[model samples]
Target chain A: MPRCRVRVSTWRRSVVGGAGGVEACRSGEVPYGGGRFNGQEGSEDSDSSVNRKSYPTTLRRHPSRMDQSESELKRFMSGLTLAECVGFVIIILTIVWLQYYRGGFAWSSDYKVMFNWHPLLMILSMIFLYANVMLVYRTFRHERKKKLKLVHAGLFLVIFVMAVIGLSAVFNVHNTAGTPNMYSLHSWLGICTMVLFACQWLCGLLSFLFPGVRHALRAWYLPVHTFFGMVVFILASCTVLMGLLEKAIFTLNDKTDTPYQFLPREAVVVNVMGILVALFAGLVIFLVGNPVFKRLSLPEDEMLLNEPIN
Target chain B: MPRCRVRVSTWRRSVVGGAGGVEACRSGEVPYGGGRFNGQEGSEDSDSSVNRKSYPTTLRRHPSRMDQSESELKRFMSGLTLAECVGFVIIILTIVWLQYYRGGFAWSSDYKVMFNWHPLLMILSMIFLYANVMLVYRTFRHERKKKLKLVHAGLFLVIFVMAVIGLSAVFNVHNTAGTPNMYSLHSWLGICTMVLFACQWLCGLLSFLFPGVRHALRAWYLPVHTFFGMVVFILASCTVLMGLLEKAIFTLNDKTDTPYQFLPREAVVVNVMGILVALFAGLVIFLVGNPVFKRLSLPEDEMLLNEPIN
Candidate 1:
């Protein structure tokens, strides 16, 4: 009877001990088989790698979102970055060209910095802007059926329409000089661009907030979104510069002026070419620095997510 | 040996019968104990009244939730149950007055018939618009430190300021007819309204979609939202009419045409008053709606969930 009692006591003890082990496994006090610590159980060790796998760094993690990277970047590049780079290079080239072309003919301010020739530069930058927009167009080309593709198409249409009207005004019709009903069209185009840019920015914001939604498009959609973002920046800069030229820049000769550009040509071309390189560089950095790309590049880093619902 | 065999047979019979009895109970046949079915019986039908206590009729549920007799007549009148009979009479009387008086002088077609007076409607609608906006403003009043509230305030300020400026142009500034600068301000204000409204609407949409968000502000927010929606429609009607008047009434007459009131003098005021009352009534109906009122009044309906997470 004593031997039987001893056996029962041991059996009871073992059963209780086995149940406690299962509970410990559930609470994650110590990882089963992943024993980095002394096999002594009870306390939990939460590694940074494990925690990072559970929760990610995202725009939600960003402490500040109110800052409009888009608006600020467009303003900064147009007002400062492009003018500095292109202006320096042009000024150096102009001085050299002047020295090289020492004909007895004197150059008037109009001849030296006529708004008409800047139309050529405007066309060049416009082509660059068009090219940028096209990159987005091509990336999302495969996404013919997506709802967001409508947004993409609508957005590019804004820039394209504005560009068409502005080009018509600059080269063909000289609409900016206020011939008949053209200024109305120019003004309407500006309004259209403003609306389109606002919608695009909102979409971009939604994308940033919800990473899962960043690409309902394929592997190329990131490049597409990024491309349009740059194109929009380019187009918005062009629009604002055009607005400034129409309202503020050309009248810089007044005594009331703090002086914008010395010979600030408001003729559409110079207004639009002033904000590209900086946009390109900043966009590249932002794209390259994206964590999605980092993960894509380093397949091993994504291994943390391999286990299902761990 | 015969006694042992008999005892075994009786035990087997009892086990089989017990299993059948349990299955019958589980299958919901003879549910109330099924005690006598296997023949270990009591007075089987003694107290059905005791059993009646277990199943409460649907009519005996919550008093407020019940469909009461005679009070079904009140359900046809939205929110009529809450008001005293006198209040219901007053509402009916007011509706009758509105439908009768809503015409030329009562509603002030001075603003309505002429496009110039379009601002009159805008300026008037703003009084109620301000009221509705202010009510919503109070709900977010406690959330003063939130950036979204600031955005909302900015939105209101933009709309109010633009309307004030536009109305001022219509009434106070006669120079609105000629000067490009005045038109520019009008243009700027219009653009500002478009941008501000887009932002407000998008932000409002996000707040409405996210119920668990502490500052969702949706239920209290919707009446105001609908109120603004109605106001927008009213403004659009007035503005579009004004646009037509600019082309039709003002354009046709020119500086030479004498301004003449269409209707006889006394009839004018009555018509104008009628329009205003009707507009307000319609606005109110479009906002909260009768169904919402019924739900809101219910104690368990929890329409305004205290935790803001419904």
Candidate 2:
């Protein structure tokens, strides 16, 4: 009975800590010190306020704020790790399914090989890099705001380069295959998202990072900036999803059977990749929007603001 | 010059009143009188403190609360009308595209006819009704909380009935065609969403509406309920999007041409419908998430609580 109680308490900790849900049932968290030190066990309620008031100074001899910060840290780490794993799975499944299962990728092998680079590079740039850009502020809350802005700008620049390369791959495939470019809804949406993404990056840099902009103007633009940042990210995600389904039909059109015949291994993998990518985007949006998991803005971070970059 | 100035000021009023954003640009209000009273304007900044200090009594020549409430009313009205239009458009376009362009709907004339009802009913239930469920709290914020809960419960029951009909149509079509059911990723995700939706409705009814639940327990469950409610709505939207793509390919696959050939009229309409549905979902999610546009909570809303229903 005692063993079961200990095991249950550990499971609850990791679950409440936001890392290992039922999926990661092992609930692995290396105990740093006294195993029985956390006196705030047995209560499974998720009321942060209740926990704060009841368990303060009881869980440890440390300050209540320290205990709260630790929990917040655990939540942040767990959320990011889960989101990262999902993002990586999307990339890996897309590449493996396209490369090994269909045909391997090559520089200029054929339309098929060229088409393969489209999903891989686009996912890498749009989903992975764009997600990191959204997360930079939250992840490095302790860092100087000006430094984080530079990092954010730098990451967006990388995304621009990757996006150009990815777009070229798709256009190259279209030209080689004698297929018309921007003919379908997918291509239209994809190109629009890319163009808007470029414009958004340039606009963000000019408005936020560029020197000589008055503080009042920057403050006025802040809400619009945050709104568009999220909007553009969502647009990119929508375009990617549209591209996934468009590609699925193009590659999996079994004339002998119905279209999107998921009985086939490749089709199933394609659909799974699409769902996983959508879920990853959803998780990213959730993490960014939720205040409880957001990083605490520090005094030094605020002081570092208004420092212009070249 | 005075006429032009009046027109400009009217436009500004609508804009500052939160009804002129792209998502709510129709600015449709019932106009319950007292037209030129709101004096909160010309500041051109979103600083809440400035607004509170400047136009506290000037607007409507009444209490500041009245001014804030009027703006909230405008927002609520505009948001609802816009969502209603989008929801109706989704239903109408699905019907027209499937009925007029793709040979029209029938009960058992063919599998295609049976499949037509699937999209229509599913959109009505999943997209339309589910979205309204999210908006109800915001839309009817001044209503008694018990009454709103009843309305919510009642609306969900309607969705349950519609969902049953939608599922039956798809299953019947599959059975008649002698095709396996629940095989594709679309089907898997759709079914999972439906099951979860049902469970959510039941759990919400039990915990929030039931008489036996303690106040502390109910408060503890509120956040979880709110979180899952949004999550399930998102999942449903995602499933609908997948279904749109799946159905588009199945119907638009021209053997002689590339898959999803947009030259076909039906194909173009289908793609347009998909994009519109996505935009609609995006708009709905945005309105629900934005606090500035949220409705003002009422005092009576809190008193009538924990009433059981059939």
**Best candidate, DockQ:** 2
lDDT of 2 by residue, B95-130 (tens): 898789667777884877778888888888888877
Worst 10 residues of 2 chain A by lDDT: A29-38
lDDT of 1 by residue, A189-232 (tens): 34444455556556544543333442233222343344344434
- For each candidate, the alpha-carbon lDDT, in order, equals 0.30, 0.58
Estimate, for each residue in B8-32, the C-alpha lDDT of model 1 and write its tens digit.
2332232232222211121111122
Off by over 4 Å in 1: A1-113, A119-239, A242-310, B1-159, B166-177, B180-310
Which 10 consecutive positions of candidate 2 chain B have the poorest summed lDDT?
B32-41
The CAPRI-style docking tier of model 2 reads: incorrect
Computed on C-alpha atoms, the DockQ of candidate 2 is: 0.12
Candidate 2 global TM-score: 0.75
